[model samples]
Target: MTVEVLRYSAFPEDGAGGNPAGVVLGAASLSEPQMRAIAEAIGYSETAFLSPTSESDPARLRVRYFSPRAEVDFCGHATVASAVAIAERYGAGVLTLETNVGLVPVSTRHDGVELTATLTSPATWTRPAGDSAGEALDALRLAASDLDPAYPVHVAFAGNKHLVVGVRDRWTLDALDYDYGALERLMGREGWTTVHVFWAEDRHRFHARNAFPPGGVREDPATGAAAAAFGGYLRQLELVDVPSRIVVLQGRQMGAPSRLVVDLRPGSDTVEVTGTARRLTLTPYDDVDLP
Candidate 1:
C-alpha cells in the first residue's frame, strides 16, 4: 500500500513563504515507526499524520505530529496546514483534532483562493523558569540587559511547553544567534519545545523568533504553538488585557515572513491562533518498510 503526503506552507498568504509542513491523511494503519520515518524523509520542521476517529464523528480526527528527530505532543503550523488541506479536499468548516495534549477545535475558512485556519488551544498556564533563565541567555549568547523588562522570562504552556523571553528590541530579535547543542540539551532537560524570544512592537503587535533545537531546526518561520502559549503567558502576567487580538510577525530574518493572529477572550482560558496556509505540490520520497 502506498501513503500520500501533501505539502503546505502555513501562516503566510504567499505560497513560497511560511513554515512548510507535510500532511498525511488516512494514516490509521501507519505505525509509530512508519510515521517517524515518513516525517524524517519529508524533512520539514514538523509533519502531521491523521487518522479518522469514527464515522459517527465526522468532525473529529486523530492527529499526531512528528519532527525529523522526534515525535512532539503538539505542533501549531502543521495543524493549520493540515486543516487547510482537509478543507480543500472536503470543505471549509470545523474539525476536532485528538492530539496528544488534548482535543483541539479548529475552524477553516476560504477567502478567495487563500485558506485560513484557526485553532482554539487547550487550557494554558505558566511557571517560573527558575535557573533556566541564565542557561537560556548563555545558550542564546544574549545579556540580561537585552531582555525586555516588561515581560519577564517564564516557561509557558498551551498545548506544549515553551520558554518565553521578551527581547528589548526588534533588532535583538532579528539578530538571533545560539549554540544549537547547548540549547538542545537545555530544552531536552526542561521539556521545552522551543525557546521563544520576542519583541513587543506595541500592546497589540509583536515580533518573534523561535529556536527549535530539539526538533532539529535552528529556527521556525512560523510557530503556532509558541504563539498560543505566548498569548496565555501575556494574559497570566497581565501584559495584555483580555478579549484582545494580537498579531505576531515572524521569519523576517529568514526572508520567509509569516503572520499569526492570536485571540484571547475575557474570562476564557482558551487561546485562539489563526493563520493562512497555501498548498504546495508534494515532493515524493522513497517508500518506507511498513510492518
Candidate 2:
C-alpha cells in the first residue's frame, strides 16, 4: 500500500513563514521503519502520523511524531499542522490526541480567511539546570554575563523537555553560533529536545531561537513546543501575571519570520499554544509505498 503525505507550514507569519511539517492522515498500516524513512525523505524537522482511535470517532487519534533522526514524544508545530489539515478536510472542531507523553487536546477554527489551531499541552513543570547550565553555555560559546539576570536557566517541560535560556539582548540571540557536536552530546545526555534561547522584548512580546540537535536540525524557524515550555518557565518563575498573552517572534534571523501566541490562564497547569498552518504544494514523495 502507498501512504499519502501532506506538507504544511505551521505558525507562519502571514502564510509565508513557519516551520514545515509532514502530515500522514492514515498511518495505521505503516510500520515504524516506514514512518522513519518517510520522515527522512520529507526532510522536515518533524512529521506527524495520525491514526484514528476507533471507527466511529475520527476526532480522537493516536498520533506519533518522528524527526529525521528518531521518534519524539511530542511535537507542537506538527500537531498544529496536522490539526489544520484535518480541519480542512473534515471541518473545524476539536481533536483528542494520544501522544507518547500524554493526552493533548487540539481545537481548530476557521476565521473566514484561514484556519488556525490551538493545542492545550499536558501538565507543565520546571527544574533548575544545575551543573548542566555551565555545560550548555560552554557549548553555545556564551558567558554567564550574557544571560538575563531576571530569567534564570532552567529545564522546562510542557510536552517535552526544553532548556530555557534567557539572553540579555536580541543581538546575542541573533548571533547564535554553537558547537553542534558538543550541544548535541549535551542534549542527548540530558534528554532535552531543544535549547530555547530567547530575549524578552517586554512583558508581552519576546524573540526566540531553538537549537534542535537531536532532531538533526541546527535551528528551528518556529518551535511551538519550545514556545510552550517557555511559557511554563515564566509561570514557574512568577515572571508573568496570570491571564497573560505573549507573542513570540522567531525565524527572522533565519529569513523565515514566524509568530507564535502563547496563552496562560489562571489556575491552569497546561499552556495553550495557538498558530495558523497553511498547506503546501505536494512534494515529490507525497505518495510512498510501504517497504
Candidate 3:
C-alpha cells in the first residue's frame, strides 16, 4: 500500500521562505527503517511522522522525527509544520505529541488563510560548555575572538542538546563556514543535535544560523528548537528579563529568510516558539520505493 506524505514550509512569512519539513500524518504502519527511508527520500532537514495513540483519542499523537541520516528525539520546525497541517484538516486547536524525550503540547490559531502554531517546549536547562567548546570552535574553524564577550558558550537543552555560541556581530554570523565531516564527528561524540550560532541585533532581536551536521544537513534555514533552547539560555543566565519576547531572524544568509518568535514567561521553564507554516504539496508512496 502507498503511504501519504505532505510537505510544508515552517517559520516563514509565506510559502517561499522558512525551513521545509515533511509531515506524514498517516504513519501507523511504517517501521523504523521505512520511516528513515521516507525521510531520506523526501530529503528535508527533518520529517515528522504521526501515529494516533488511539482512535478514540484523536488529540493524542505518537510523533517521531527523522533526518536523512538518523532519528532525532524531537524537531521543532517539523512539529510546527505538522501542527499546521493538522489544523488545516481538523481546524486550529491543541494537540499533544508523544516524542522520544517527553510529551509536547502544541496549539494552533488560524488567521484567515494562514495558520500559526505555538509549541510549549519541555523543561529547559543550561550547562557550561566545558571541554566541548574548544573542539566545537575548532570544528567550525572559529576562534575565541569571534565570540560575543557578553554571552559565553553554553550547552543547552530544551528537548535536545545543542551547543550555543554567540557571535560578536552579524558579519561573523553571516560568514558561517565549517568542515562537515569534522563537525559531524564532534557532534556525534558529544551527542549534540546542532551548533546554534547567533548574533544579537539587540536584547530582544537576534540573527541566527544553525549548523546541523549530525542531521546530514549543512545548515538549517530556521530552527525552532534552537530558538526555544536559546530562550532558556537567556533566562537561565539572566541575560534577558523574564516575561520577554524575542524574535529570531534566520536563513537570511542563505536567501531563504525565516522568522521565529519566542516567548519567555516568568517562573515558567517551558518557552514558546510560534511561527506560520504553509502546505507545499502532497505525495503518494507509489511515487517512490519503500525500504
Candidate 4:
C-alpha cells in the first residue's frame, strides 16, 4: 500500500522560516512500523499521523506523533502543521485530537491565504532539576556561571517533558555546543524530549534553542512542545506577569529562523501555543510501499 504524506513548515517567521514536518491525513491502515518508516524517510524532526476516530464529529481525530527514532506522546509543531492542513482541506474550525497524553484541542483560523492554529496543551507542571542540573550543564559543557541567576533550572511538562535552562546573554545562547552522546544518555534516563535553552530579551520577548538528541536530530529549528513547557515553567515560577503574551524566537543560528507565540492566562493551568504553518512544495510521499 502507499500513503500520501504532505509536507509543511510550522511557526514560520514571515512565511519563510520554520520547522518542517510531515503530515499524513489518512493513516488508519498503516501499522506502527510502517508509520515509523515513513517518518524516518521524511527525515523531519517529527511527523503527524491522523486517523479517523469512532466519534461522530468530523473535527475529532486520533492523532499520533513520531520522530525518526521513536514515537512521541505529543508534538506541538506537528500538531500545528496537521491542524492547518486539516483546516485547508475541511475548513477552519476546532479540532479535538486524541493523543497518547490526552485530548488536545486545536483551533484554526484563516486570514485570507494565511492559516494559523492554536493548540491548548494539557495541564502543565514544573519541578526542580535537582542533581540532574549538574549533569545537564556538564553535557552542555558549561559551568554554573553560564546560567542566568534569575531563572533556576527545572523540568517542565505540558504534553511532553523538557529541561528549561536560562542563560545570561544572547552570546551564550548562540554559542551552543554539547556532547551529543552524553546529552542523549541523560535525556533517555530522564525521559526528557528536549533541552530548552533560552535567553530572555525581556519579560515578553525571548530567544531559544532546543537540543533534541532523542528524536535523532541534533537540534530542532522550532520546538512548540518545549515552548509550551517553558511557558508553564514561567507561570509556575511567576517569572512573567499573568495574562501575558510571550514571543519566542528560535532557529536563527541554524538559519531557519522561526517564531512561536505563547499565551498565558490568569488562573489557567493549560498553556496555549499559537503559530502559522505553510505548505511546502515537496512532493507528497505517495510512492512509499507500506505493509
Candidate 5:
C-alpha cells in the first residue's frame, strides 16, 4: 500500500525552527517492528503512525509512536505533526487519537499559510524528586548549585515519566555535556523518557533541553511530552497558579530551535501543548519492505 509521510516542524513559529517529525497517514497495516524500522530510516527523533480504527466511534483512531530506536507510548512532536497532517488533509477540526498511553485529543486549524495543533495530554501524575538528580549531575559533571531553587527537581509524568531539572542560570543550561553510556543506563533502569533541563527566564518564557539517551539520542531539540510533564511539575510544586500558560524554547543551542507553548488549568490536572508543523521529505512507509 502507498503511504504518504508529511514532514512537519513542531513547536516553532517558522517552518525552519522546531523539531521535525514524520506523519505516516493510514498506518493501519504496518506492524510494530515495521513502524520502528521506518522511524529509524527516517532518522527523525520520532515519527507518528495513524490508521482508521472506528468510524462509528469518532474517538477511535489508532496512533503509534516510533523513535529512531524503539516504539514509545506517547510522543508530542509526532502528535503535532500528525494533527497538522490530518488538518491539512481532512480540514481543521478536533481529532481523537487512541495511543498506547491512552486517549489524546488534538485540535488543529489552518491560518492561511500555516497549520497548528494543540494537544490535550492524558491524565498527569507527579512523583517526589528522585536520587536520579544527583546521579544525573554526576554524569554531567555538574554541582548542586547549578540547580534552580525556584523549581525543585521532580519526575513528572503525563503518559510517560521525565526527570525535570531546572537550572539557576543560562550559563549552566548552555554548558551541556554528559557521559552518554552512564546516562543511558540510568534512564533505562528508571523508565525515563528524557532528562528535561530547563531555565526559566520569566513566568511566560523558558529555555529547555532534553537528554534522550534512553531513546538513543544525545538530546532532543523539542520535547512535547516533557513540556506537559514540566507543567505538571510546576503545579505539583505549587510554583505556578492554576490556569497558567508558559512557552518553552528548546534546541536553540543545538541550532534546531523550537517553541512549545503549554497551557495549564487550575482545577484540572491536564496540560495542553500547542505548536506548528510543516512538511519534510522522507521515504514513504510500506509494510512489505518497510520505508
Candidate 6:
C-alpha cells in the first residue's frame, strides 16, 4: 500500500510557523497498525490519515488521527493541515471529513501565500467538572493567584475534554514545568485529554500552551481542537461575548512557533478554528518500523 504523504505547518501561513503534521492523501490500504507506526515515525503531535469515502454523503473523506502513542478521536491541526494541503492541489471548496467524533466540514481559500481554512468542530460545548479550581491548582502545582480571575478553571470539550487554566501573565506561562507522569495519571483518572495552560493578553488574544502527556507528547505547539474548545469555554463563562474570535500565540519557546485562530458565534457553543499550511520535509515510508 502506497500513500502520498505531505508535511504541512498548520495554523500559520509562514513556512516555518505552526505545528507540523503528516498529511496522507490515501491510506485505504494501510492498516491501523501501519498508520500508527507511520505517525510515530513522523514524530509529529498527530498525523492525519485520509481515505476515499463517498461524495454523495457530502463527506468525501474518511479521516483518522494518530499520535505516536495511540489513535485519537480528533485532531484540529492535522485537519487544518490536510485541508490546506488538499486545497493547494485539488482546489478549494467545502470538504467533508468523517472523523471518530463526527462529520466535520472544512472550507479553504488561497490568496498568494495566504491559505485559510475554517474547520467546523464536532458540535462543541463546555461543561463544569466536579473538581474546582483548587484541585486543578494542586495538580498543576500552581497557586490560585496565578490563574486569571476573569477566566476560571474549567473543563472544555470539543471532540475531547481539556482542562482550561488561564494565567495572569506571560511570566507565569513561560515558567512551565509540571509533573509529566503525575499529570498523565491525573488526566487518565479524570478522563481529561489535555491541560490547556493559557495566558490572556487582551480582549481577543492569548498566549497558550497545552500539556498532553496522556497522548505521549509533552505539549503541542498549536492545538486546534483545544483552541476551539477554549473558545467555547470562554463563551460559556461569559468571559467573552459571541461573534468574536481569538488569536492564540504558542510554541515560541519551543522554537516551532505557531499561530491558531478561534472564531466564535453568539448563542452557539461551537467555534470555528482557522489557519493555513506549508509543506514540510517529512515523507511517508512503507515497510518501516517506527521507534
Candidate 1 residue spans exceeding 4 A from truth: 13-16, 282-291
Question: How far out, in Å, is residue 44 in model 3?
Answer: 0.6
For 44-106, candidate 4 gives per-residue lDDT tens digits of: 999999988975787889999999999999999999999999998889999999999999999
For candidate 5, give the lDDT of residue 197: 89
RMSD vs true structure, all candidates: 1.8, 1.3, 1.5, 1.1, 2.2, 2.4
Candidate 1 structure quality by residue, lDDT tens digits, 175-281: 88999999999999999999989999999899999999999999999999999999999998888988899999888889889999999999888899999888766
Highest-lDDT candidate: 4
Error of 1 at 242 (Å): 1.3
Query: Could you give candidate 6's per-residue lDDT for residues 101-206 as a string of tens digits?
Result: 8888899987766778899887777776656546667767888788787886788999988899888899989997887877888888887888899998897998
* lDDT values for all models: 0.91, 0.93, 0.91, 0.94, 0.84, 0.83
Candidate 4 stretches with Cα past 4 Å from truth are: 282-286
Q: Estimate each model's TM-score.
A: 0.96, 0.98, 0.96, 0.98, 0.94, 0.92
Candidate 1, position 48, lDDT: 97
lDDT tens readout by residue for model 3, 128-234: 89998998899898999999999999999999999999999888988889889999998999899998999999999999999999888999999999999999999
The alpha-carbon root-mean-square deviation between model 2 and the true structure, to one decimal in Å, is 1.3
Q: What is the lDDT of residue 90 in candidate 2?
A: 90
Local accuracy of candidate 5 as per-residue lDDT tens digits, 71-142 = 889999889988887777668988889988888999998778788899999888888656777887887667
Q: Which lDDT tens digits does candidate 2 get at residues 1-291?
A: 688999999999987989999999888888899999999988899999999988898789999999999999999999999999999889999999999999999999999999999999988999999999999999999999999999999999988999999999999998989999999999999999999999999988999999999999999999998899889889878999988999999999998899999999999888999999988884523776666
In the predicted model 1, the residue pairs found to clash are: none
Candidate 3: lDDT of 215?
88
Candidate 3 residue spans exceeding 4 A from truth? 282-287
Model 4 / residue 147 / CA error / Å:
0.8
